[model samples]
Target: MTVTYLLVDGENIDATLGTSILGRRPTPEERPRWDRLLSFARDTWGQPANGLFFLNASNGLPMTFVQALRALGYTPVPLSGTEDQKVVDIAIQRTLDAIADRDDDVMLVSHDGDFLESVEGLLDGERRVGLIAFDEFRNTGFTPLKHRGLQFFDLEHDTHAFNSTLPRLRIIPIEDFDPAQFL
Candidate 1:
C-alpha cells in the first residue's frame, strides 16, 4: 500500500477559514473539529499513513487545541517566532525534505505562496503532492500549483462534513444590541 501523509499549516488554514468563511478569526470555542477535518482529508486521499499539523507557538494557541490535535491522531509541530519570519514555513520545508526521498504521497494544507517552490520541487522529483485550502478565499496563491496539474481540495466546498460539529454563529437582534457603547 502507498503511504500517504497529510501536512497542515495550521496558522494559514485557520486564518483562511476565519477570513473567508467565519468573517473573523475562529475563537477557541469555535475551533473546527480536528477529527472531522482529518477524516475528510483521509477519505479524500484514501487513508493517510500519518497526519501532521504545524502551528506557530508564538500565536498563543491553547494547549487544549494541541491536545485535541493529538486526540485526532495528528502530530502537532509548534514552532516559535514571529509570523513574518516564516518559521512555520521553514519547519514544514525541513520536514518535507526529510521525507522527500520516500515513495509516499503528500497532501499539503496551506495557501501561502511561500510553499510554491517546495511543491514544485516535490513534483519535479516525481512525488504526488496535493494542496488543500479555501479556493474561494482571495490570495490563495495556487496558480503555480494548478499550472503544474496538482490536485486541490477546497475546505469551503466540504463545509457540510467539516463544520458539522462546530457550533453555529449566533446573531444578536438589532434592538437588543447597542452600538454606541464604544463611542
Candidate 2:
C-alpha cells in the first residue's frame, strides 16, 4: 500500500490534544512517543509517505511546530487568513483534487467542520479518506463521517504512553512563534 498523503491541522489538533491531555504546553519529554505516532502513520498505510501539515498563514504559526512536523517528514502548508476565508481548507481541497484521480488514501487530521464537503468530495471520487482527530464526542454532526472510517485518536488514552516513550521533544513556545503584525 503506497501511503500517498497525510494532512495535519497543526494548531487545531495539537492545541486540543495538549490542553486536554498534557494539561499544559507539551514538554520535550514526549518526543520519542510522538515519533512513534508518526511511525504509526507510516506503518498504518505502508511506507513512501507524503505528509502535509496545514496551518493558518495569516493568524500565524510557530516555527518550532513547523520544524517539528518537517522533521517528522511532513511538508508544512500554511494557509493565509481566517477560517471564514477558508484558505487552509481550500489548500487541502486543492491537494485532494490533485490526487482524487489517483487510487490513493488520504489521512486528514482535523476536527474542523469545514472539511466535511472536501472529505465528501474525496470519498465521492473513490479516494479512501481517513479523518484523524482527538475529539471524544462523536455526535457532532460528523459522527456519520466518522462511521465511515473516521479514525479517532484519544489523546487522553495515548498521551501518557506517548510521553513515557518519547521524551526531550523539541518545543517552540507559542509566544515566541507568533508572527509579527505588519498592520
Candidate 3:
C-alpha cells in the first residue's frame, strides 16, 4: 500500500476559501467538514493517507477547534508569529525537508507561491508532489509549478466535498423594520 501524507497550510486555505467562495472570512460556526475533506482526498488520491494541518498560533484559535481537529485525525502544527515573517512557510519547508526522504507521496494544500521552489526540488528528486488549492486563486506564481509537470487538485471544482451550506444573506425593506419595538 502506498502511504500518502497530506500537509495543509490551514490559514492559507481558510483565507482563500473564505474570500473566494464564502464572500467573507468563514466564522468558527462555518468550519469545513473535515470528514468530507479527508474522504475526498482519499478518493482522489486512491490511497490511505495521514493529514497534517498547519495553523498560525497567533490566530488565537479556540481549544474546541483544536479538539475537533484531533478528533478528525488531523495533526495540528501551529507556528507562532506575525504573517509577514513567513513562520508557517518556514515550518512547511522544514516539514518537507524532514519527509523528503520518505517513500510516501506528499500532497500540499495551499496556493501560496512560496512553496514553488521546495516543490520543484521535491519533483527533481523524483518525489511525487501534488498541490491542492482553489483553481480560481491559482495565478502567475502557480504557473511555474504547473510547468514542472506536478499534479494539482482544485478544491473549487470539488466544493460538494469541501464546503458546507454557506449562510445566505437576506435583505429587508425599510418598511419592514421595527426599531421602536425595543424601546
Candidate 4:
C-alpha cells in the first residue's frame, strides 16, 4: 500500500507564522492541529500518512508538545546541533532525499527553500509530491515545480487545520474569494 510521507518543519512554520504573517508568536490556540494535517494527507491522496515532525532541540525537547504530537500520530524528530547548524533542515533534506529513492508519495510542510534540491529529485512524476504551507509564505523556488506536477495546498485555507482563523492577508483570486466568509 502507498503511504504519504508527511514531513513537517515545525520551526519553519512557527517562524513564518510569527515573523511574516502574524508579526507575533503564535499562541497555543493559534497553532495548527497536527492531526488534521495527517487526516488531510490521508484523504488527499487516499493513502496512509506517516507524519514526521521535526523541531529544534537546542533548548531541549518540549516533552509536552512531543507527547501531544505522539498522541496525534506524529513521530517527533528532536534535533540538536552546533550554534550555526540547521539540524532540522538537514535532517528533513536527507529524509527527502531518501524518500526520493522510494515509490511512495510525499508531502512537505514548510516554507523553507533548503529542501528545493531534494524536492526536485522527487519530481520524476512516478508518484505525487506536495508542498503544504501558507500560500503567501511559500518559497519561490517551489513555484517552478508546479509545472512539473508539484502540488501546493494551503495549510490553513485548504486544510483548515487551525481551530480559529489566522490574520493573514493574501491576494485572493476572484473566483476563490468569498465575502460571506468575512461577514
Per-candidate TM-scores read: 0.74, 0.65, 0.76, 0.97
lDDT tens digits, residue span 22-84, model 1: 788887656555666677667776756477988888767779978978988999888888657
Q: What is the C-alpha RMSD of each candidate to the true structure, in Å?
A: 8.8, 11.6, 9.7, 1.0
As a TM-score, model 1 comes out at 0.74
Query: What is candidate 3's lDDT per residue for 1-183, written digit by digit as tens?
Result: 566788888778788768866888787657566666666667776888788888777768667868888899888887788668777888998887777676767888888888877777677545567887766575447666766667877654453443454443323348756677337
Clashing pairs in 1: none
lDDT of 1 at 53: 89
| Regions more than 4 Å wrong, model 2 | 18-34, 59-61, 82-86, 124-126, 137-139, 146-161, 164-183
- What is the clash tally of candidate 3? 0
lDDT of 4 by residue, 141-182 (tens): 999999999999999989989998888998899999899987
Q: How accurate is candidate 3 locally (lDDT)?
A: 0.72
**Range of the 10 consecutive residues with the lowest summed lDDT in candidate 4:** 20-29
Collision pairs in model 2: 28-168, 28-169, 29-167, 29-168, 32-166, 33-166, 57-79
Clash counts for all predictions: 0, 7, 0, 0
Give the lDDT of residue 84 in candidate 1: 78
Global lDDT of each candidate: 0.70, 0.62, 0.72, 0.93
Q: For model 2, give the RMSD to the true fold.
A: 11.6
Off by over 4 Å in 1: 28-30, 59-61, 82-84, 138-141, 159-161, 164-183
Candidate 1 has an lDDT of 0.70
Q: Model 3, 54: alpha-carbon shift in Å? A: 0.6
lDDT of 4 at 3: 94
